[model samples]
Each structure stands twice: as C-alpha cells, then as structure tokens.
Target: MSAKESGRNVVAGIGVRGWLRFIWRQLTSMSVALMLLMLLAIAAIPGSVIPQKMSNPQGYARYIEANPDRVAWMEKLQLFDVYTSVWFSAVYILLFVSLIGCILPRIRVHYRALRNPPPRAPKNLLRLPAHAQASGVTRDDEEMRRRAVGWLRRSKRYRVICDDEPGGALVVRAERGYARETGNLIFHIALVGLLVSVAIGQLYHYRGQVILVQGRGFANAQVDYDSFSAGSAFDPASMCPFRMTLDQFDAKFRVSDAQAQDFTAHVTIDDNATSSKEQIKVNHPLIIGGAKIYLQGNGYAPEVEVKDADGEVAFAGAVPFIAQDNVYTSLGTIKVPDVTSGDQIGLVGYLLPSAEQSESGAWKSVYPDLLDPVLVLTVWRGDLGLDNGIPQNVYELDTDNMTQVAKDGKVVTLVVRPGETVDLPDDLGSFTFNGVKRYVALDLRHDPSLTMVLIASIAAVIGLAMSLFIPRRRMWVRIAGAVASVGGLAKTEDENLQREVRSLAEYIAAPDKAPPVGPGQAIQEGKAE
Candidate 1:
C-alpha cells in the first residue's frame, strides 16, 4: 500500500486523533524513542538504592520496618519494588506501543522510498548548492554531455541527465548513510522485545527460600519453610524433587597470633538421585536431584546427656548450637518438659570449640577447631517457653519463669573439656561429655524455570545486539536531459578561452537543453565570466 494510506490506517485502527493524538503520535515519534532510552537509565536507580527482591529480603524488610509510614507510602507508590511496579509496567507498555507505531510508519515510508526515484532532479540546477560550468570543449554537444554523464555515473554516484544544446551540461546527485534510520528502529524494537522478554520472566518465573537447621532433612513441600513467594503463573509442580540430608559437617578456621582467615567447611549430602552423593563447601554447591544444595554455614553441636530423677538417661545426643562470637563457640539449650520431669526444668549453656583461660581468668576460644574444646556451664531451672507461642531463638537461653539459685561469683566455675565429664553434687544428677559432631546449614533450592529464563535472557541480548549495530540504507536514481544553456557552452577549447574572455554560449544553447538549467547556468556562468 501507499505510505500515506498505511500510516493513516495504523492511526485509525488505534482509535486516536486529537490533542492527545500528539501524545500517541509523539510516543511513537522519534522524539519519544530518545525519551525512552533516557527513561530506562533513570528507572534503574531505585533497583540499586532499595534492596531488590533478589537480595536479602530480611534486610529490605528491616529498611521498611525502620520507616513504617514512609515505606508504606513507598509501597503504595511502588517505589520500593520499582521493577515490578505497575507504573513501571505502564512505562514499558507505552514504550513498546511507541516502538511499533514508529517502526510501522517508517517501514512504510522506506518501502515507498525504495520504489520511487527522487522527484525529477530539481528544475533549477543553478538554484542548488553544487553547480559548475565549463565552455569550449568538444564541438559535438551530445559527446561532451555523454562524457560528463559518464563521469557522474562513475564517481558522483548519480543517474546523469545531459542537454543536446551547444556545449552541454550534466546533473549529478548522491546520498549515503540512509540506512541509519533502520538501525535506530531496530535498536528501539530490540529494546521493546527485551522488555517483553523480561516481563515474561517476571510474570512466569518463580523462586523461594528455605532455611534448614542442622540435622534437618526437609522435603520439597509447601510447609516447614521460612518463606515462600511465587510468580503470577508459577506452578508448584514445577518444583524439583528436592530432598536433602545434612550427612556430616566440618569447619576449620585459621588460628593465628594476628588475623584469622582461611575459613572452610565441608559437607556431605546424599539424595539417592542423580549427582546426589557429593561434597559441598561454602563456595561450592552440590547438585542434588536437579537442585542446588549449598552449605551456607556451620555451627557447633554440643554433646548433651539428660537424666531424670529416676536416674535414667532420657536424652543423650549432640544438640545443634549456634555460634555467637568466634572460634565455633555456640549457644544452645537442653529443654526438659515439666510434664515429663514433673517440674519446669531446662539447661542453657554456651559451648566453645577451643577454650582458653584468658589472662583475666575469663573463658575464650583460641581457635575454631575442637583442639581443646570446652563448654562453661551456667545453670538455670525454669519453664521452657515452648508453649508460650512466642518465637524463640534456637541459639539463645530464655531465662523466664525461673532464676539462678546459687551465685558462683568469681569463684564459681566448671569447664568440661572435650573427653571429660562433670559430675553434679546434688540429686540433679551428672552428665558426661562423650563426643561432638559438627553440622552444616544447607540451603536447598529448586527452580524449574531458572534455565529457561536464562536462555530467554541470552536470546534477548543477542537480538538486541543484532538490532543495534546493523543499519539498512538505500539510494534512489532519476535521470533526464541537461539544459540548453549548459549544452551550448564551449564546444572547443577556443570557445572555452573565449567564454573566459566574454563568449556567447548561453545566447546560442538556451532553447534546447535539460530544462531551465540551460538558462540558469548560462546566466550564472556569464556573470562569473
């Protein structure tokens, strides 16, 4: 179709024509394209300032918590999560619409340009910026004109026109870099395509987080997780068959007089599936059953022995303890239900990986490994707050509903070194330190769409590059005759010299040449003469 009709159809189909029509038109306008390019750069600021959803969520929550009122307002404004904000989506959609609108019209115009040669070279050649004349060349005007046209076709990139009048004249034109517009459009369209691809990922992809304590073998289920959030079209079945067992954990740290470095942990995971049996570390993740299993951290596991008033060992095993300061030192609890013990009773203790007697007579860890591990006991008899419905830290000792009976003061102390047992003097009974076991904190994740998203991202990038760097250009050619004034100039070197000395080529060839060029050229050239 014709370019004019095609452009009209596009506008009509979109149902817009008014002052706002400029908005729609300008949105698709080249001006709007430049604006979108700038807008994308400006829009990226919020993602960096605020904590993105991809990063630590708790830290971002803390930021919101710090300013409840402001964050609430920001949420309303979608500023906190700008990438997923409705306003951001609107900007993206508008930019895309503008892209299509602009490209279609340009495509139509380009098609038209390709089909039509430039309007017959301007009627007045002397009126143009580039015009030159010479007189007194070959006597045959056609031959001189033909020679000039050949020169234009060879070096001037022009479809030439010549006059049959006396000394003959030629017209030449050339154009280059016209394909730059096509390149610009491709770049814009590629940007729109990339946005669409990113939106598809944002709407269709899913990711979740799960925190597993030591000795915990979590199944890939909806429950028993710290948090979970899914994409709009995410499906639970897309989750991989994730089953992780924290088989064994080992941590080693540098023990030096100065700085401590070279922190390392080794963990063994078995899933009974493909790539199941593997050893993982902090930087290395084990691929188990099509999921990534990382040993996020490691902590102490104190060997605890529990006994009742009946002199029977009710519980005896290594209880997971969280590290507090350094050197694998951890805080853990040994809870004994009041119903089972017939009284509210619990023991909270701090265990150290390597304990040393400071010069001030305080306990501290000299190293992280269990070289001479020790656990200083602080006795507490209380009702454990399990049924209180209040969340408690697994690495803390809750001293509610009870008190410390005896004050050991500076003299009170008991350090159960590794392989040693401490005996209680009262009927509270005694426990032995058998051995210790280290446990790893594994973060097991499964996202079936991760690879697909990556693939789409790569494709989008390549498409974008192809569209940006490549340009499409074209040339249009029109040819006709030169004017009489040009044709009549200087058929001989004699006339050329005579023209320089005031000759009369224009008076002779003004009637039978390429339009007014013959007249305009003669008038201009004679003045110069």
Candidate 2:
C-alpha cells in the first residue's frame, strides 16, 4: 500500500537473521542455562520413580500389565524410556549448546584482560572508598615512591607500575588477584568437561544382572545375564572375559522383629589373567576385570525332586523362591515337561522358613531363620507353554489351559517338609522337598569415563572455592614533597580494603618501622610492570 506501512511491516517482521540472533542470545543467557539445568533435574524424576524399559524390563512389563489403560499413553510419551526419550535428548543438547555459548565469549574476554595492564590510578585518591593520607613523611618524593613500590611488590605481592604525574608527583599503581577471574573461568570450563564426561559414560557403559545359586558358576557373556542393558555405542565383544562361582551366601536377621541385619555373598572370580576369592556385601562391591560386581539381593532356592508315576526321575534342581514377606515367606514355580505319561505338570507354591500353623489352620513363617521350613504347593496338570517357541518367565506359571489336581471333587493342597515325599492325586506323580540353599542377585557395571568424571568433579570444586574466597583488588600510592596518599579499590565487597589502605599509608610514612615481610603476609602477585 504505502511506503510507511511497508517499512513498518518490515521492522515488525524482524527478518530471518534478526530472529535467529534474538533466539541465540536468549538461549545463551546464564539465566536460561540455569533454568534448563533445573528442568533437566526435574525431568529425571520420572526415570527414577517409574520402571525404565532399559533398566528394568520385567518391572516395566509388570507395570504395563497392571495398568493397561495407561500403558499406551505412557509409551507414546516415551515415559518408559525417559533417559533416551526425544524430549530429554532435546533438552540435553540445548543445555550443552547454551553452556558452550556462554563460556567461549567469556574465555576470549578474560584472555584479553590478562594481556592488558590494570586501569590507571584516579586523579584524587582521597575520593576513593578506601583512602588514607600521611602528611608528615620525612622521605623525598622519589625515595617515598621507591619504598612504597617495594613494599607493595615484596610484602603485599602486587603488580606495581611507577609513573610521574605532570605536576612532578610520583605515582605507584599496584594490582593483584587476576586469579579470581581465572578461577571463575576454570569452574565453568570444568562444568562443561563434567557434562561431556557424563555423556560419554552414558554412550559407552554397560550393565547386567544375574542370579547365582550356591555352587553355580557364571561367565561374563551376554547370554549368561538374566537381564542386560547397554549404551548405544557399547559392543558385546568389549566385555571382559571373567568367570565366577557362588561359594555361599550368608544372611543374618534380628531375632526380635525378623528384620535382616547383614548379607554377604562369597564368590571366587577367575579372570583371564588372574584369579581371586572375594566377598561382596550390600554396600561393598567387588571390582575386577574393569567391572564392578554388586550384591543386590539374596533369597532361598529350595531343592526338590520330582518322579513320574512310573518311578522315573523327571526333574531335579534348586528353584529360586522370591521372598515376599519379612519372615521369608517365598513363592516359586516348578515345571515338569518330561513326564512319562499323561500331561506336563506344574508345582506352584510357597516356602515358609520357620513354618508355623496359624490359629485359622494356615501355614505361615514366624522367623527368617531355617528352624522349621516347609513347602506348601498346589499341583496343576497341563501344557507349560514352553514348546510354543515363546519366551516365558521361569518365576511364573501359566495355568490358562491347565486343570488343578483334585481328589474327591475337592482341590488338594500338598504339605511337605524337607526330607519328605508326598504322592500326587490321580496317580500322576510324586513330589519331594529336598533341603534349601541360598542364592544371590548380582549386578555388574562397566563405565569407561569414570576417571574423567571424577577428575572433572574435583577440579570444579577447587575452582569454585577459589572464585568465592579470592578477592580482586587494586591500590594506588601518590607521593609529592612529603605528602603521601594511599587508595584501594576492590572488585567485590571486601571488608579489609580500608584497613589494608591505612596499613600501607602508615608503612609508606615510616618504612624503617614497618614489620619485616613474611610468607603469611604475601598476597598473590600479578604480572610485572
């Protein structure tokens, strides 16, 4: 329409380059960077509260099954994989860019400031915040200036420059504490290093979990782990070749409340280069083969023997029972697919350590120790669904196509103790409860960037301390025909600035009476003039 209207439209539009510049400035601001860091911490809360797919597959599956209506929405939002989610990655990348953008310009400015000298002294020293003047100086102007410069250089350890004013007065300007800004820059640089180290650790780390029954051996292979997860850059071949056998597991519980007190897993580890015996406790881990083995949990695995009706041993082994209660009430499953006749059988039941009969004629455990252990089970005859080529959880039994063994039109519950045998209904089979053994769940983790992360963390702490405690300051001394004046200025709110200026003025007035220089009295010296 009109030139003015077109110009107004153009100004309002803020063309592509202008908009880009504005966005970059906002993103690189320190306030925005801090906000993003806080947001990242908040976003990690979900990963800790909810079961992550990579870290806890079985728990994730159970959650999905328990909350079917919410599963679809949760998965759609990538809540099940929070750390690797698209939104999380976007935030992480933006924070990285913001920190780098905030650091580069500061580094350049600091470099230039380091090369240049401190600002010249002001005309009138008495106008400064911290100022002192000594009128009765016996020394000449040149002698006073030289003494002041020497005291600032040797005793106070400041960078000194001597200049003659146009009015024939001698000025000694001194400055110190460039290290304050250097420490600040170092802290920010170390922060960036820490972020990069963490990202690298995430990309190259691997973790696996396995349950080891007593006397059973395990190898460091992908197939040996019950559950395993690794970063995108991790390779299976990079795993350290190590083998270990569970010797024994010891657990102690308090007698009064049956609360567990201690747990230890004794193991023998054999790496390709060496072998050793080690004990892994709850907080103490075994470090070998570039991996850390942690004892995560402990439970009982009851040994059992199963025989078909034809008197043939069908199955036998120690079955791990997950503890469900404080007194060691555990649940487990046993499947017999090699039965000689009829159909497959599944024994689903609980093991009660220190078993006792309740008032209602129910079996329960009273203590965590194995004083009177018993097995209470129910027999089911059916297809175990193992031959269907689908993976199944060993801890669970699917009875959808199975029928419970019954006697006289009533369900039969088998009650057996260690070293006892019982007959099954309908002449199907015989089940025996053979003693119990302990098992331990172990988690192994390998991270290549741990050293770098540790060093960066330490450096960050040191730099932060320096930036907070060290003070940047400048001092000026002017001597003209027996009148000597001193002034001090600090970049930060320094409480001792006035005291320091007064002390310097007194020293300049009578250098012979000043205290001798000592190591404790020395401040950090800056570049020489």
Candidate 3:
C-alpha cells in the first residue's frame, strides 16, 4: 500500500478506537463520580424544598387554599412533590450505573496488583525524588553493592537488587505498601454500596400512622390506618399486624395551677393474642410483636344521663370535646331524635370542663381539668332526623330543621353543671350532666425493610474506606554497561584531574598561576602554558 493510503487507514482506525477509549475512561474517572455527586445533591434539593406527600398531604391542601396561584405553579414544576419526580429518579439511576461502572473495574485492577510484583527501581538513582551517594560506602565493587543493598533492606525496602556492570553497580529497591491501591478501590466501591442501600430503603420500606380512640383496637392494616403509605415494592401483608388493645388510660394533671407541668398518662396495653399485659407510662412504651403502645395523652368527656317523663333511661354516655383553652377548656354537643310518646325532640348544649361565671353571667371554662364542669343546654322539640338517612354526631345535634321550645323562640343557649337536671316543657322530657370521664388517643405505626437499609449502609461504608485510603505506585530500575571513553579522558586530563592535583600542589588556595579553574579550562582548550 502507498504511504498515503496506509496513513488514511491508520487514522481511521485510531479515530474509532480513540472514541471508545474516551468513553471507557470517562466511565472510570473520579471526575465522573464527582459530577454524579453534584447531580445527586441537586436532585435532593427538591425533596427538602417541597413538602413530601407522605409527611403532610393535608398541609399541602392548606397551602393550596392560601396560595392558589403559587401552588399551581409549584405543582406544574412538580415542586409540591419532587421525590417521585421522573427527573429525580433519572438522576439517581444514572449515578448508580456510573458508580458500578467505576467500581467493578477498580476491583479487578486491585486484585491483579495484589498478586503481581512491584516494578524495580530506576537505573539513575540521582534522578529519584531523594538521592545521595558516598564513595566511602565501599572500595570493592561487590562490597559497595552489598553495602547499598543491606542499607536499603534494613530500612524495610524489600526486594532490593544490586546491578553490577563494567564501571560499577547500581542498587534497585522496592517496598510492600503496594497493596495501598486496593484500599483506595475498596473506598470507592463502599460509597456505591451506600447509594444502593438507600435506594433499597426507599423502595421497600413501609411507614404510616393510625389514630384510634382510647377504647378502640387498631389492626396494622392499610385500610384501618387514618393515613398510610408504603414503599414502591412494599407488601401490605408483610406489615406488622401486631394489634394493640387499650385496656385502660389514666391521666392526672398538676393541681389547677398556672403551669400544668405534671401532665402524664399511665396506660395498660393488651398485646393482641400475646396474652401479656404491659403497663406503660407517659414516656415508656409496651413493645409486643414489633409493635409499641404508649400513653400519648388524654382528654375529658362530660358524662351525661338522659331520661323521659316516665323516668325511662333515654341517654347515658360521655361526650368528648376538644379543649378550647390550654388549661380552661370548652366542650359542647348536640342531641337529636329525642322520643316523647313516639315523637322526636332536639337539644343542643355547650359543656365547660371548668365552668366559671363571667361578670355578665355567661358561662366559660377556667381550666381544662373539669373543675366544677358545667353544660349549657337548649332544647328544640321537632324532627330529630331519625327518618333521614344522614348521620348525626352524638356530640352534635343537627338543628337544620328543628325548632326551639325551651325558654326561647326556636333556640336557647344555657349552661348545666354536674348533678344538674334540666326539664323540657311541652313534653320534651329531660337530660342531666352526671359527671365526666376521660378518653384517650392512640397512635400506631409500622415499618418494614429497615434492616435491609442498614445492612446496605454498612457495606457501603466498608467499600468506601477501602477505595479511598489506598494509593497505587511503582518504580523501575535497569543497569546498562558503561562504555569507556579514552578520547574524552585525554582531552580533559589536567582539568578533569584537578581535584587530585590539589594533593600535588603545596597549597589548596592560590593567589596566581591562573587559579585552578583557569588552568583546568586552558588544558581542555589545548592552550597549556
């Protein structure tokens, strides 16, 4: 082939090969890993900036209510929920692939280096980073080589070699820290392991919360939970179904003081089917079958008893209410479908946990702990919605279609205390506030696959340590024959041998005689005087 044609073929081959090599190098480079790290950080930015759906779905609804336009814009950009965004997943996937690409090859390289010998020292010892010499090391050539090798060996540099040629011998040296390269590879791989572990945790774990009433029992089921969610691959059946039954909940607050610092709840829990009863305090919890139960808190429900004109028991139960004040609180309820000779009567009342009379005779709470607790009742004699399919709150009376008959024109609001009874005129019967009983709130949660996540995290740490703390290095040495140069030796006889002439000269320092350097140069120039 002609030179030009051959060159064309060679250039074409190189172009193709170089492209592949560039790709391989990029995949294996630390720069690529660092860039992936940056990408990962950027991907995580949205998770923190945007409220995750799992943490607060209703809170986002509130945000939407307040900032309709802003919420719309954020939703358009997937900011309201970014964790499940396609862009974030893409970033993590690409990072994982690149990390594996870099780590797998490093493993092979480390294995080979461990099994192979280190390179010999370089022939030119003076060219090394640090070098020194001493003619007094030894006079005999073999003795010199032995002494140099001995010095290096004693210094812990293994595999020291002595190379003897015509003129002299050069020493070769090496050490056993070559396995440092493997340590570096382990460190990198360990980081990749960490990433995998976190991804597993995100994909296989289950986390949610369930709020149950004090007397109620909540099963660790998806539908029973108030708000529940699992990882992408989590199985609902695998969730810890450790049913917890609240046997009893006890709460005692500090004596009606300014600061109720001594608030605590003692709970008795029955682990479902475990047949074991556990007592749990405010801070302590009972753990059974991977489920934990605690006395989270408690609230009061005013106990009321209702009766007809014939003294027939109409209603006798506790009505729970949310506290209005931190200490002093408000509790209220509406009663519908009161029967009187096959007719219906409606009643509404506001109960105060600690009822206190105001200057104007209006009733309100002075504290949360039912001190002189009272209820204000207003009765209406009409349709109590018993015929309607719509449900009514036992704590609330639907007065959408009822009329008041007790001391008012359609409605009346008043207060009643414990042992207090209010009679209904026009055959509406009566109701009484007997006392108050406290109710408790329970929260349950279950999560699976935390163990897998932890294992992956630990493996990643080990791999990272191995990869970072190791370095790869080698040295080479070769002793070539030194050629004799008689012509050069005769040309610089006086100048080259000047140091020897110092012994021949009487004085080491001279005032004249062309100084040692001048005469040495003149001799080289063949201009001897």
Candidate 4:
C-alpha cells in the first residue's frame, strides 16, 4: 500500500490494538477507579441494613415473613445473603480489578522516575514561576556554581547536580520531593494488599452462635451450635476442640430509667489440655483456641415443671425464651410430644420480669430485674407435629393442628407467679413456675487473616499521611561570569517556592551590600499581590 493510503486508513479508524489500548486507558484512569470505589461502597450498604441469613437465620426468616410481598424478589436477589450475593461480588471484584489496573502503570512510571535524575534546567530562568537575579557579583561563574551546589548539598534534602553549558554558563539542578510520588504508590499498593487480606479472610473464616443457660456447658462441635456460618473453603475437621461452661450471667440495669447498664457472662473454657476462666461481655470477647467468644445477648430462661393427669412428672427443665424487649418481656413455647399418660400438649407463654399492669389493663414488664415476675400461659392439646420429622423452630409453636383449651366457650388465660401452680382445663396436666435463670447468647468466630488486615490498614494510613504532606519541587541556579540567577518550579502553586528563590538569591548576593533592587522588590510585590 502507498504511504499516503496507509495514513488515510489509520486516520479513518483505529485498529484492534489501538482499540484495546483505548479501552485499557479508560479503565485505568483515576476517575474510573474512583467511580468503581463509590459503587462498591454503595453495594455494601444492603449487607448492613438487611438481616443476613448466613449470620442470623431467625432474624432473616422474620424479615422475610414481615415483608411477604417482597419475599420472592428479595430471595431472587439474595438480599438475605448480601455479602455473598452475585451483584455484590461482581461490584467488589470490579473495584479491585480497576484499582490494580490503575496502580500497576503508576508503579512502573514511578520506578523509572526514581532511577532517572532531575530534569534539565530551562534556558529562560526569568520566565519561570519563581525567579531571582544577583548582578555585580564579585565571584566568577565557577565559584558561584560551587557555592550553590555546596549549600544545597549541606541542606541534606536535595539531589544536587552541577553542569556547564556549551557557552561556559554554570548550572546546578536540584530536586527534593520524590517521596511525594513514592508515598502515593505505597498508599495504592497497601489498598491492594488490604483487599487480598479481606478476600482470604472471607474464604477461611467461620462464625457460630449458641445460647448457654447458667450452669450449662457446650462443646465446640458443628452439631452443638444453634446456627453457624463458614467460608466456602472452611474445613470442619480443622475446628479447634474446645468446651465452654457458663458459670453465671450477671446483668445490671439503671435504677433511674430501667435501661440496661451492663451484661457479663462468667465462663470457663477448656481448649484441649488448657483451661481458664474469662469474663465475656459486650465488646469484650474471650479468646481461646484461636477463636473469639463474644457475649451478644442476655435474657431469662424460666424453670418450669409439668405433670400429666395421672400425677406423673412428664417434663421438667429450663425453657429459654426469646427476649421481646429491653425490659425482659419474653416469649417461649413448650411442647410435650410424649406425655406418657395424657394427650400431646403445647404451651405458649410470655414471661415478664418486674411485671405490672399498664394503663390499658394489659400485662407488661416494668423493669429488667427479677422483681414480681409473672408467667401467662395458653394451653393447646393435639398433634405436636413431630411424627412427620420436619424441622421446626424451637422458639416458635406450630398450632395449626392443635386445639386451644377453653372453659365455658372462652380460652382460659392462666396467670401464675414464681413458685405457683396452675391446673389445666379438663385436668389434662398441671403447670408449675419455678423462678428464672439467666442465659447468654454467645458468638464464636475465627478469622486467620485479621492480623494481616490490621497491618495493611496501618500501612495505608501512614502512606496517605506522607502523600498528603510532602510536595514535589525543583530548583536551579545558573551563573554566567559575575551574574547569578535563581529559579524554581513546583508541581503546585505555592508561596514557599517564591520565598525559597528569594532566600537563595539573598545568599548568593552578599548581605553586607545593599539589597538587589528590581528582583527583591519584584518578589515583595508578588507577595503583596
């Protein structure tokens, strides 16, 4: 092809290589990286606002039930598993890729610049952003160049070089702020390291929760946990063998306003051969076997007893109730699938600590402390739904196949206090309330990459500070025989550059003599302007 035709084709359209270069340049631009970062942050918001099924199945289930109309869409979008959702993952992955693309080229450019010397001095020093002149100098060009080089080197802040032009003019070129670009590169590199650490942590971490009543113990086993979540790569066999026993649970409330003050769970831990006791409270976790045990919640578990119509003890134990409010109003269900001498029975009840009657004549808890506790029970008798073998929530009662126990066509409301007994309708059973014991909800978590994340975070902060404080600058001093000229240029417009040029001019020209007229007055005039 003719050279003119080739040039015409190139101008008409970009080839495949040119198109690829254009796309890459756009992706690696700082503006594109910033937009990706903002999009990633917005994508993470739903993870915090919505209840995640991986962490809290009960809460997620309640959310789904509460928003029945939106359940299908939420499930399809994986709103209940926001962190692992496809849309969130795509955004996170894109953000990391954009950052990497943006930083790699910058790193290469910075490395080359660090290896190269400061740029050559411009010929017209008078036209520079900052300039100062010293005329009628006693020393020659060689001495003036030597003194300027010596002074800059003595400052110990600049990379100094002296050179001579073809016309015998001496020049000294100095640069002091390479650290500004170095810090910028370090900050970006640390961000990449942090993202890698977080990805690794997410792949290997595990978290599980259990409710422990006072005096009860639990082993660190998958089957023992009420709910558990683990990374895709987590191995069950790698879990440390540990056991924890809840010795006591103490909760304090503000006497003035009845608000919760503090909660502490005293626990003894056995990690293989080692054993120790620790107080686990909110924000204070117990570390054992490379795992952390955090106190998440506290509530009352009422001790109850039930006897069949034949007067034989059927069920007797502590039933944990889910707390409904800060005042310790709790809801629970007790199912007696095998009564031995009577029909299967289910009891739904509410327990109130520090009970009192509201203005509307309804029962409510006045405080969180154990003062005048009351239990209101509603009895139901029929199939307990255990024969079908479907899993059911222990905290909820399935009353579809059950009939309420009533007298004179009205459902009986049995209100009994601690240490009191209430007989059931039709003499089916007898219920006894035997005070309450405290229980704690414990979250156990293990993440191997937490230390790496911390280190990267600290490095990022240091790099950011250095990048913000340091400024890139260059200075040049040129001497021709008896005349010396000083010039400076800064990457940013800064008053310090003018001051530095003025100061260097004053040093070159003897201070004992009268001040240099035009340049000194011009600097002062510029400053005033």
Cα lDDT, all candidates: 0.55, 0.87, 0.55, 0.83
lDDT of 4 by residue, 262-360 (tens): 888998988778888889989989887788989898888889898888888888988999889878899999888768765788899899988898898
* Best-matching candidate per lDDT: 2
Give me the runs in candidate 1 sitting further than 4 Å from their true place. Answer: 1-23, 26-190, 193-217, 224-229, 248-276, 288-290, 307-319, 322-326, 331-350, 377-385, 388-392, 396-414, 419-434, 445-529
* Candidate 4 Cα errors over 4 Å, as ranges: 1-22, 42-53, 56-91, 136-147, 154-156, 310-314, 324-326, 340-344, 356-364, 382-393, 510-529
RMSD of each: 12.2, 5.4, 13.1, 4.1
- Model 1 agreement with the true structure over 77-181: per-residue lDDT tens digits: 777677778777777777778778887887788677556553334444333322334333323556434444444356434434332223233333333233444
Better model by TM-score: candidate 3 vs candidate 4 = 4
Worst 10 residues of 4 by lDDT: 520-529
Choose 1 or 2, whichever is better by TM-score.
2
Candidate 4 lDDT: 0.83
Q: Which order, best to worst by lDDT?
A: 2, 4, 1, 3
Judge candidate 2 against the unseen true structure and give its global Cα lDDT, from 0 to 1: 0.87
Candidate 3's residue-wise lDDT over 1-529, tens digit each? 8868777643445587899888877866778878978988988887786566665665565566567778767877777667667877787777777788887887777677566554444545434332222221113434334433453356434444444444554434344444455555555666666676667767665555543445556666778765555567777766655565555554455665634454433343333455455565656655544545455555676777767666677666776655556664644654534444644665565667767888997876666665677777776666676566543444556566776664544445546678888776665567777776666554443334355556655765665564444322222222222210001111112343222222112111112343533322211111223
Candidate 1 Cα deviation (angstroms), residue 112? 6.6
